[model samples]
Target chain A: MDAREDRGQQDISGIYRMYSKEVYQYLYHFIGSREAAEDLTQEVFVRVIKSLHRFEERSSMRTWILHIAKHVAIDEYRKKRLQTIFAGTLLKLLPSTEGLPEKELQDKEERTHFEKALLQLKPKYRNVIVLRGIREYTVKETAEILGCTEAKVKVDFHRAMKMVKEVALHIYEKGAGVNEIS
Target chain B: MKFPSDEEVLQEFRNRPDAVPRSEFLHTLERKLVEVEQQHRSRSKMRRTTIRLGLSAAVLLAVFFLAPIFTRLITHPESIMTTKPEAPLVLKGQQLKLAEVSPAVKQTLEKLFNLVPELKTMEPKVIGKEDGVYEIVFYQKEQGKEQRYVSVEMVAATGKISNYENEKAMNEEAPSPTEEEAKQMSAAFLQALLGDEFKQYQVSQNANNDWSSVAYTRYENGLPVFLDRYYVGVNSKGVTYVNTPEGAQPPVSSEAFPKPGTFLSEEEVIAKVASLIELTYSLEKDTGKPLLTYSLETTGYFHAETGEDVESVSSHTSRYSDVISVKPGGKKLAARDADEVAKVMAEEFGIDMNGVSFEADERILPDKKGVEGTLYKSSGGTEKIMVYTNNKELTGFQIRGKIETASSTQHDNKPANAKLTYEEAKEKAVQFLEPYLDSSVKELKIDESQIMMPTSTAYSFSFFALHDGVVVTDQNYLVNVDGQTGQIVNFMDNFMKPIGPFPDLDTAISREEAVKQFLQSHPVELGYILPVEKETLQLRPLPVYSVDTRAYFLLDAISGKLVK
Candidate 1:
């Protein structure tokens, strides 16, 4: 399609038209932290302007922008960790604020448990699971976004599913313990 | 596509779409990006607009250094545009082959042309070969310089004179000089050195005279011995090189003939050193090439008088990475790779330490170049330190991950007179090591002295203790120290010297004069002058100087100055 389009000249209006809702929704489901997702989504577009030249046209514009967002989030994590260390703290706890609608709190809690489980996976497995199962990007799209071959993505996806099953078992066990206490 | 069993799990998470409030998130990031973008844009704009003007200013400064030299070359008639008819041809095709010429082959032929000064004026004969390199041979002799033909072979890929060999064939070709001829050459040298000291003294070849010739043989005292056949009668304040037959031509560059004393006079050495500093500084300022401050440290190696290789002395500077800058907070930083920094340092500073490596932390800059750092030295169970820079402010250094140094006191062989209060010794050491100090040394501490095993027959060893963070012991001579006086008995530090800052224009003129007299008989001219900016050594806007009359002159400058 319009692969040769000058993404830099397109500006915020073009970004809004093409990616605003999709990126927001992707981030929201991935993090379960509403504030971070919203903040990171905006940051992703800001970076788009700053690193316009690095978009080498090898990947779709959407995939390239998502890659930037991923790196930015990783940098944010590192910055926060360094600050905590400098402040003489042992751990900078992740934000755990629950902001789901009351009606969906149960589903949100399950997702939160899965998110913790996902964190236990290495970054590669976690990214694959999120892209394939959560974001619904196809295996090829996931490979292209990650700069890997489609076959490798499929293998990682299979391993991610197996890890999730293990995570699901742990979640159910924890739920049962809470029920017994109640 | 068939739905996976996990679709329900994914759909549940997607439906809720847990995200922070959109408006607040966008507001914070939008502000930060705008600020960063504005700052970057402004700096880039400034760099583009003002850089050209800065470069022109630098060119004007360089022209100031070159104006006199250029003028001298233009006005000289005998050498004006002297060229053999076939000078400008390229032999790049398959028609070339390689050949080797021996220095012995040329030396045998020197006697035939010794009487004719014009025959010595021929340029090095260039012979191209089938290999990707070319050879040029020339014979150079002046009243006082060494009589040898220097042959250089330059490779094609890097146009560098990869091979340099000297031939001594002149002795074989020309029979040994008759006693009368030797006597005449000796008389000429004696006149240059005699100056106002002794006008009418008789000259004789005396092997016993300390003022005899000193070029070919290494004497028992470690001084070079010139052939003893010619001598100058000296009734003088001090023996000088002018008395020697070859004194008129001294070495072409300082690398060949060194002044005979174990140590240079402080003023003499500093005066020479100051010119080098001026040259490096002006070149950087004019061409915009990276400027470096450099220093050299000498270890006694053997007895200073006996000329032995005893211990190693190293110097360092206060520069770390050229591209890395430590952020004020020390937690975050920006940098380029260490390899890039090393590459530029080698090109700019002439330092190519093997296995050169760096680390960035609160202590080191991560990715920038030209940053300053400290040097560390260790010897005799003690550590010593000095600051260093990559810019060649001084002459020589072997830069590495950390510069290893020892206090002057650690060397057991140092003269006893070198004893100073811990503070006094360090201050003296700094005079030599200061040009090489890296940014790292916050302070210096002197430690205890220990006797070291002697590395040579001339002296016993004593070491001084010192530390910055690393312990280094500097060497001293036990015999040279007066136990009752607690003072160093005999040590010379002329080589460890400091250079002066750039003097006013007239002094610059004198320096130009010295170089001019030095190059008076040589047949090379200033090629096209290119513009450079001082900070980055990057080319800037300006015209290069050159004469339209020569093709090979361009080749020589490219091979010499550019590689240098």
Candidate 2:
């Protein structure tokens, strides 16, 4: 232990320990893949590393980190739009098999079914659904995360949940098609 | 461990070790971070960018806006504006008009006005950020500038109201709420607003102002965590404070910040704090032992993680880094007659002293106790200059000019006396002061020296006499050299303040006893403060237990009691 050792700055590890799980979960739902979420979580921390010095204390560490994760989600979404097939292939490579917080969505069937229906949603619908519904952020917070009006977040989340219900009903009618991951 | 850049971090994911089941994600990232840190630390210090000195109108406006007043507004309770709204009717920067708000919001506003009698006379400034979230700001009446009485953000969509701030104590005539009543009332308000989540917060009285002050620090594992603080304002007529800025974390959970519990013991914390201490001279604050002798820079707080001692930012600058690079050249400045001074004053400072005569004033605030000086005053008495010298040679001169600033010398041809660099200005300052350097004074160390304007306008310098390396802080000998002309702009020789009839260090209490008194007087408080990350100059929030630097201002040597 060097007396002048830079442990204070190394508390980035502490920060990562604190916020990484939430960031991973946020990225996981937003991106619709477990492996991609893991990679993007790493990406979020990397961005955190570069921008940590510029982190203003006005906002909490969690809020700032979530803001960064939302940015990563948007960038990933944009790349999925531009780098379509490449991102699509990478997203599909990993199944939602392991390390799922079982307590969040009950049994495996419900979790897979919810995830499956979520994957079917458009970016706009998925954004509102994930932020407002799952994260339980306020309309103002969700609007801030999505960079849109509260009206839009409110309307989108309602419509998105309606669409999810329709999709779930459609899947259950076909005896819950688990093979159709994407 | 240092954090890694994500692009470089991707390869580590590819090379993720399979054997390490306990998660090497942090370890890999830590290694990458340390590698980055090593590379960064090896780099040379960035050059300080020099800005050209220019006294623009914007700078003048800024000075008027930011300059602090002597009588404290909150504490004095006698007063307190973005720009104090003129006449109360002319509200500036009101984004949302009364007509712009919904009918429901109008009803809500009317209800609030009737609920609180103070709201009736106050001017309302409503600013709506979203569809339903409206921030209604109320300003006080015509006696003083428009003081914001309350700023509350209401969420109409979700039957929730957040971000309520009541500055009732700002009103000089506002009633007082005792510390206990304030806590109870504020706690009730917070409980209603946050529902069951308010139970986690521990109430503590903020002892700054005369009025009611309370702060709710979120407790986890029976210890207050960083981030989540629901503060109560000066007075709580309405809800005091419900986290003003939208992004501020609510008193929801302390699952994120677990660093508070890991803080070092008091002895270890004191031990770590010793690292920030350096042998420096400080003018003891009303010390039972006189003679501004040796004092330690024992103001730094301990990093709770371990032994790393981080220096806390104190309001007063340390005299340890004083540079006396410039020696006296004995270039004595001769005393100028009234006409000669008037010409320089008019040309340089834009002051018209056409018919003003220098009147002798025995008792003046400008110079030392017995030094005879002439006061040059214009007809309006707004612009006054005190010249502290006989007709023989110049000792010092103090100027208080009118609103319009000193005219800047900006020439294209580059005159013989162009704006001098910091070093050049120092030399010029020495030339002016060399003649007045009394041989009776002990080592006169330069306490502070800096260029006034970023445009290299003027070089301001202050020298203090030190007794055996310990500086007498109030030895206010000062000199300001004009950066443009390299001429002496302002000079003062007020170092004749009687310091002491020296005391023996042996009679003083032990250093250990002094440290104990310091800790006893100023208890180390647990706080999450943003310390600038030296590796990148970013603010990193660190939770540490440390005494307030303001409170731990001065330590007494003999009585072993810390002085504010």
Top candidate when judged by TM-score against the true structure? 2
In model 1, which runs have C-alpha deviations exceeding 4 angstroms? A1-13, A77-112, A174-182, B1-4, B19-24, B27-36, B50-564
Best by lDDT: 2
Model 2's TM-score against the true structure: 0.45
Q: What C-alpha root-mean-square deviation, in Å, does candidate 1 show against the real structure?
A: 34.6
The DockQ score of candidate 2 comes to 0.01
Please provide, for model 1 over B147-171, each residue's C-alpha lDDT reduced to its tens digit, 9 standing for 90 to 100: 4364544444323223333343322
**What are the DockQ scores of the candidates, in order?**
0.08, 0.01
lDDT of 1 at B290: 25
Model 2 Cα shift for residue B337 (angstroms): 10
* Model 2, position A53: C-alpha lDDT score: 45
Each model's TM-score? Answer: 0.26, 0.45
lDDT per residue (tens digit) for residues A43-145 in model 1: 7776776565433333566787777766665565455532122112111222233553443344335554555555445556766777776666766567656
Full-model lDDT for every candidate: 0.35, 0.50
- Please list all clashing residue pairs in model 2, or write none if there are none: A53-B538, B2-B33, B52-B454, B52-B455, B53-B454, B53-B455, B53-B456
Error of 1 at A12 (Å): 5.3
